[model samples]
Target: MVNNKQKDAPHAQWPEAAQTLIALMHAQGEVARLSEREQLISSLLVSVNAVLWAFNWETRQVLYVSPAYERIFGRSAGLLLADYNQWRDSIYPDDLEYAEQSLAEVLRKGAVEDREYRIIAADGQVRWLSDKCFINRQDEPGQPVIIVGIAEDITDKKHMETELQRLATTDVLTQSSNRRHFFECAHREFAEARRHGSPLAFLLLDIDDFKLINDSYGHPEGDNVLQRIAECGRGSLRRGDLFGRIGGEEFAAVFPGCAPDMAVQVAERLQQEIQRLRFNHDGQAFSITVSQGLTNLTEADESLDSLFARADAAMYEAKRQGKNRIIAA
Candidate 1:
């Protein structure tokens, strides 16, 4: 309670002790600061959506994993730390080999930044991950080699990309391949067929009296007919055949490895399917028909344009002769 001398006595009697006391106080402050820093780092890791992990490659063990492991994988981090296979088992079966191979690549390359794969979460939901990993340490005399990585959930991004691709490649109303996408694929198929000398048939189809139907039944019904026709084309074609809506009331198909006879049968089946389709408007039922022009890849053909010209001319010929018929070129 009282004294200036009392406070100074210890310092005066043992100067070394006083210095040690001061050093001890500073150390305590440093410890507290370190603890706060650690807590802050922990909090930041927990708040992030990506999982950060460290693995002891020599021992084949997981050294540490962030809290986001549980959130993204829907599995316990404790289980992962206990057994590395927990992570392995979660990888999609088809992707497991590539995942392991790519991770191993990090050893040679020191980093793998372009890795992406799929994993099945604990809730049985499949999620995509863009996992980038690096060698945290090189092999030392006695130190354990460490591999560190960050795994980010990219399911939403993958889905968005897929939807974007579908939109870019698909017709909105007919749900068939769009004209540009169809031509792109057809040209590739044409080159392949030419290279292999394989039979390739192209068929062009046009709905007969389409304007009259649209005027009588309204544009909505016309759209419905187009969708139905696309559905028929999809159902009637072989697995590898390509079909698309190329223009208003006009559709195209590329049949790879299909001979002329088979292509004719397929075109006939599609025609019959369209004929069987019955649409109703204002209590009146009506049926639609299509004229098809079919052409086979000839030795003289150089590009898809030539095939298109022949098929277009043949389709016009069919339309001129009569409606609802198939003509071969």
Candidate 2:
């Protein structure tokens, strides 16, 4: 317990009470060390803007919730540490098992993993985040030392991914799904509807005399017609419907949960809209029209070949009828 004065001081000058006070000061040094450790942890949490969730290895219960919990998730660690479900329930339902599975895997291997999941906010808004942690394997039975992790908000990153997906699947010119992306998506919709015993329809459409327009007024004018028609058709489409360009001046529409008759009605509207389409080129007014073929696939198939074949046949039938008309098959 002696630091400096205790070793050199005379016994008469240092009474029993003075020696006792020196011992007490040595004890206070231990207290100061403890305080410094706690402050270091507090500063660490604040510096990185992180919530540290510390768990005891053997009890499998949370031992500490750093104040960063309030700063990040708008909740107190005191409440969260008392109940594990408070944090578990905040995770998105779809990601709940993922989180549990990841933890189980980590425990078995004593490894660290960086994972992400959605968190439901107090305002009922959902956000995504990622965590990084090190698995502490200190002296314990069937346990670890401490499970500490840091998390960050990735909601904006998730939104950016969604917008990028839209760009990949859509055609900038016609505002329709591109040909390759359309078939991939349509086949999925067809298979799902067929599995559920639901009805579905497909429509094949082509502008009447499209080549003549391109040959006469040029491709730009013809493109103008296609864009306008897309806008008009999209206006009448249901939220789940899809329309896409499959070839030059050729388009396909997928009608999920709709019967053949309903598809025929949709085709009729498209026909009328195209028939009435008008545009001006260099102050010379002109109009364009289209012929459409409509068909339904009652049987489920992995390939869109058969469905398109039927619609193609029906479309030729419309073309043969002098164009600017809809024929259902």
Off-target runs (Cα >4 Å) in candidate 1 are 1-11
**Residue-level lDDT tens digits of model 1 in 1-329:** 87999888876878888789999999999999999999999899989999999999888899999999999999999999999999999999999999999999998999999999999999999999999999887556777779999999999999999999999999999989999999999999999999999999999999999999999999999999999999999999999999999999999999999999999999999999889999988899999999999999999999999999999999999999997999999
Model 2 compared with the native: what TM-score?
Answer: 0.65
Per-model TM against the reference? 0.95, 0.65
> Distance (Å) between predicted and true CA of 55, model 2?
5.6
* TM-score (C-alpha) between model 1 and the true structure: 0.95
Candidate 2, residues 206-251, lDDT tens digits: the string is 8888888888888999889889888877976777998998888898
Error of 1 at 102 (Å): 0.8
Candidate number of the best lDDT: 1
Q: Clashes in model 2: which pairs?
A: none
lDDT, residue 146, candidate 1: 91
